[model samples]
Target: MKDTNHPLPVIVEQAELTLAGLQTTMSLAHNTTMQLWQTFGPLKKSIHNKSNGGSYSVQCYADNFMSIPFTPETKFVKWAAVAVFNEDDIPKELEVLKIPKGKWAVFSYKGTISDFGKFAQYVYQEWLPSSGYQLDHRPHYEFMASDYLGPNHPDAQEEVWIPIV
Candidate 1:
């Protein structure tokens, strides 16, 4: 694990996504997200719009957001989504999520996905409190590139975006 004390930089942008997944508690998030990928993978071609900066699969955590403490019992929504050029013509089974323009603390994570919890712990429990920034009311997410390998792949890389104010 690398030093998570420092984040990359803050960025603000509007994101349009088409997601298909489940609403689960923190304890079940890992398994749930994996299941989401398995279910969404075969449907990727159908859900993605080529004009929307290619397809970027994402995991969005929302619900209580920053208003409540994060625990195993906390409920949140997790999605396996692809970016889309337009909101029209969305598949009936999928849900659309728009991440409004806001500041984010972007952290580059390199390693297996299973270790992500530790990184997140560092970010929320340590980094955020001391960084002089407050958590913004938005979905926290992870942006995985199209070429991303599975959780155990050694070279896997992803960016964890924590919405902040």
Candidate 2:
């Protein structure tokens, strides 16, 4: 198992996102995420000036927040987005997502993007159950810096933000 000795920090954040992506199942998330990035990637430069800060690529697991123990068939909304300063000037092709203020369990992940599932498994199955906190009702997300390499890059780094109560 990956290291779980250190305690992950919890934080609260407010975010405004401009997204172009898809709604899909966990089993299909990988392909769908790639598609979203492909569709939204080229538009990145045009949207940066209006961004709030670092770009955010997020996953909203349900229409309303739900507890854990989700299955592979669970539906979720995946987005390739950037943090926008405001909702204004959003392109017609994109959607705006506002992440409400809430507490989050933040984990620093450095590896191939495909390995995220393993880390997530560790979080939910191992760490979270023993951590004394429950998963909160909010979207989970990945914060990617402007210089972030693609998913398959060897040295890719990002933060996995899991909403927690």
Candidate 3:
């Protein structure tokens, strides 16, 4: 795993992502995220989007509670799919991220979806402060590195990637 304290240059590339329970029908976004932590441990994954409007937007939260529906079937489905970004590519949203190319700090966490909230807290309260990095405004994401049948799946692991200056 890459050290969270060190900065690295990343290539911005568009990546296709499929989220099983990111939709409104699902009531356990936080729970699902925690389950992911329990399964694979923890790791950071990259996300991306296209310069055009048809791309999906990526989001990271301080908590596992996602007010937005995770799927496209809902009326509030704000994103089509999650994407990982590489440096030099267009920002991963219909609207621009409004940031210049640079290095970013990466972190990894894994476990059950229910534990995701704690992991997020660690990033904001613990990791970011001690890592000597400033948070960038670029869109970050939770990459599903391992297969998770559902939010309750015991064998799920996810990697979270964030952009930092």
Candidate 4:
């Protein structure tokens, strides 16, 4: 079996992004992102201005989320979205999100989505510590496309994008 781990990131100046999709309040302690996506996937066709064929999984941490004893209700904003040209095509119940241009460190992730915890640990604990870049205030997101079969697919692929200063 292929080892699941995170390698170094490719630094880049990400362009501003405009997106529209479902939004909810959740915590990583009891992640319900997949459930959110399950609801969003079938309705994706309703979005008429898709800028790309891929989707983005975005997380905006709560201000106090880093506090000790983060719990299931820590409250973070989760988005299962896709890039769009504008909000004109968005569904009535969906929300719009705008990500400003910023510097980011993007890592290529492979293997099942369940391995993300370990992969994230490697990125935040091992890689970030020596990467000379600190986390930025923007949301962290993943760009999934081509090889993205499903969350549990052994050969799934995605780009983990971490905002950096």
Specify the highest-TM-score model's number: 4
| TM-score, one value per model | 0.78, 0.80, 0.44, 0.89
Arrange candidates, best TM-score first.
4, 2, 1, 3
Local error of candidate 3 at residue 61 (angstroms): 7.4
State the local distance difference test value for candidate 1.
0.64
Query: Which TM-score value belongs to model 2?
Result: 0.80
Model 2, 115-137: lDDT tens digits are: 77787778888888878888876
TM-score of 1: 0.78
Whole-model lDDT for model 3 versus the true structure? 0.41
What pairs collide in candidate 1?
Answer: none
For residues 20-97, could you state the per-residue lDDT of candidate 1 as single tens digits? 332333344345666666766666666545353333444445655556776665555666767666776666766666
Q: Write one digit per residue (lDDT tens) for candidate 4, span 68-99.
A: 54455577889999999987958887889999
Q: Which ten residues in a row have the lowest lDDT in candidate 2?
A: 16-25
lDDT of 1 at 16: 40
lDDT of 2 at 89: 70
The model with the greater TM-score, 2 or 3, is 2
Candidate 4, which ten residues in sequence have the lowest lDDT sum? 63-72
The lDDT for every candidate, in the order shown, is: 0.64, 0.69, 0.41, 0.84
Regions more than 4 Å wrong, model 3:
1-57, 60-102
